[model samples]
Target chain A: MGTGTGLGRVRGLGSAKKGAHHWWMQRLTAAGNLLLVSWFVISLVRLPNLSHAVVTDWLSSPLVAIAAIILVANVFWHLRLGLQVVLEDYVHNEASKLGLLVLLNFYAIGAAAVAIFSIAKIAFGSAA
Target chain B: MSRNHSRPLSPHLSHWKWGANMLVSILHRMTGVGLATVGGLLFAGWFFAAASGEESYACFLGLLTVESGAINIVGAILGIGLTWAFFTHLFNGLRHFVMDAGAGYELQTNRHWAIAVVAGGIIATLVLWGWLLWPAIMGLVGGEG
Candidate 1:
């Protein structure tokens, strides 16, 4: 598992070039998730209450909104990349793997859009 | 660009004895999925509820909170599990960061790191839940005693 062989070694096909890029992105997003999620949890716990007004007010801050945007973006990207690996590894059927991968992309984008839209509505709108 | 039908496949799970490292790998994937599905819904729901208005917000909270007024106890359970998943994923993710950097690859060291990931993730999850519930617990104890 640690080493490669034959044509793959010569051509750098599977785990050499493109795979390296995926690996890098995963690590990059992992680091981002680590920092942003910490900020998210801390900010959440520190809130005086979880009421609508309180939460909206908290998210209205420019800094919090920015951090949240980054958090959402990184999380979804990391999740898509991670799930891609899972599907690739376990899904032997080519058609099913491709369909699932497409669905995964759409799901991540769609979900993140909703969350980001909600955050934007709070941050840009008049303080609640 | 030729596929090799005769090429050997990757080793099956049964080939190796189960270890924490394997568990960590599986947990990372499971928790990742759980967070994206359950946690993402909660994340979006909270924000959307807040933006929608007080009524909608209250409706959402009714599903999320632990009060008697809660519409669904399962939501609360899912929320708690989401928190644990988040923390565990986070801690284990950091351990993965070290591994990604091309460190801690030795057999013994890898196992040790895997144990740390599991222990640390669980401990972190417990500590967070404890902190969150401590106030409520104190109120209950105070009322009783």
Candidate 2:
């Protein structure tokens, strides 16, 4: 509520010194997921086949691999932020809530890592 | 002091009138959770299978496809359910963005948007899947003839 640019104020970097950083990032990544996931669906639909070779060939392209990695990152980030809100709302206990939040971080990061690694592997090993 | 102070409680679900808006609001969360868990794992599995080599990829496809190369029942169910969830969340999320921009608060407007979003999500899913599953549909249709 205090003086500063609207962006700084919403960022909680204003004189009031509060922010909606988490909430802001959630919305930001949601926008990303919307685009990336749509690309995934449409691209898959356009593919001639779902066979391993076709899929691998698709991901082998640098552009496709990059997009897939970006999609994975955005999806996992949004998943973490969205679930964090749900867990915080429903889990009343401080300790239990913290634990679940921590576990959520692990799962999101791990899954994203695995997915990205797979794409990179296909790009380097098979696609090459 | 903590024990002596009673926390104020907000009204729960029973306090609100149930409507399409409420249903969509709840489903946004429900479908989000479903996609985060089942859809997330399945996505990771697809990538992992592809990276593991041709044999593993074939094995993974085997789980999703039948001898006729049509999607198996499990695959079809999961595919439909996931698509519905995906589009529902996507549409409802777009609705939230409009609301966040400080419009669409009228009761009639909200109700209409809720109905439209739910219907639009289903129609979008069917349209996309219909195109993708045309071969499978024809396969089954030919058998009946």
Candidate 3:
């Protein structure tokens, strides 16, 4: 059920060393997202209510917190990689491209950190 | 490569017949970018509000639905739109996974599956939303006491 092995077979353009690595990670994260996000949404829909207590209690569970953290990590990683390709595709100026890539990295890392920290805080009952 | 004056230029979309697969490809990219930006920011807001305390969490929830005066319309639209976008990316990504497996490559198969991805996303979004909001929808029809 891996995406990279199949994509790797069709890598005429993405066959370069770094390209292959990037391509592989993208597929890995994509697969991770498919599973993790499905879990997230299904659980969300099943929640009796989205009240603070209910949500906090849910996050307080070790398994939920751990999965949330991993989901955030994988999501942001996939996002950064995918957006990198888009920026590299549309924004051709060397300076602009480099600047944007840096900005993208910062955004992905910063946002993921904030979300993960928030989830951890809830998991620890600090936000209660 | 040399350019020739008044010669036929490189053909683009206008020169080719439009197909469902083409739309599917474009939509997959669009939905990916949209889901990442809009869905990511919205999720960040929800998580931050949750971590900030109950008051913040309630405020966020209020704004998300019709309970508050703030951003309800925008929030409601985004709720459904992001759901659709998310489903679109999910189905289309699945389509890629199948293609990666060296199946569904026939012209008709490709086009039908492309159409299926598009249609499947819409159907799934509707189904999920319909189920979740069934009570609210029923209430609107005075089905609730």
**Model 1 per-residue lDDT at A18:** 73
* DockQ of all predictions against the true structure, Cα-based: 0.65, 0.67, 0.59
* Fraction of native contacts, model 2: 0.63
lDDT of every model, 2 decimals = 0.81, 0.90, 0.86
Question: What is the C-alpha lDDT profile of model 1 across A1-128, one tens digit per residue?
Answer: 32455555566434444757988898899889888988888888898877777888888889998999889889888888888888998898889999999999998898888889988998998443
lDDT per residue as tens, model 2, A51-113:
888999999999999999999999999999899989988998899999999999999999999
lDDT by residue (B22-87, candidate 3, tens digit) is: 999889888888988888878877888999999998878887766633336777688888999899
Off by over 4 Å in 3: A1-16, A126-128, B1-10, B68-71
RMSD values for the candidates in order, in angstroms, are: 4.4, 5.4, 6.9
Q: Which candidate number would show the highest DockQ if scored against the true structure? A: 2
| Model 3 lDDT, full chain set | 0.86
Docking class of 3: medium
Clashes of each: 0, 2, 0
Show the lowest summed lDDT stretch of 10 residues, model 3 chain B. B64-73
What lDDT tens digits, residue by residue, belong to model 3 across residues A1-128?
A: 33465556576755445747888888899999999999999899889878888898898899999999999999999999899999998887889999999998998898998899899889887443
What fraction of the native interface does candidate 3 get right in terms of contacts? 0.60
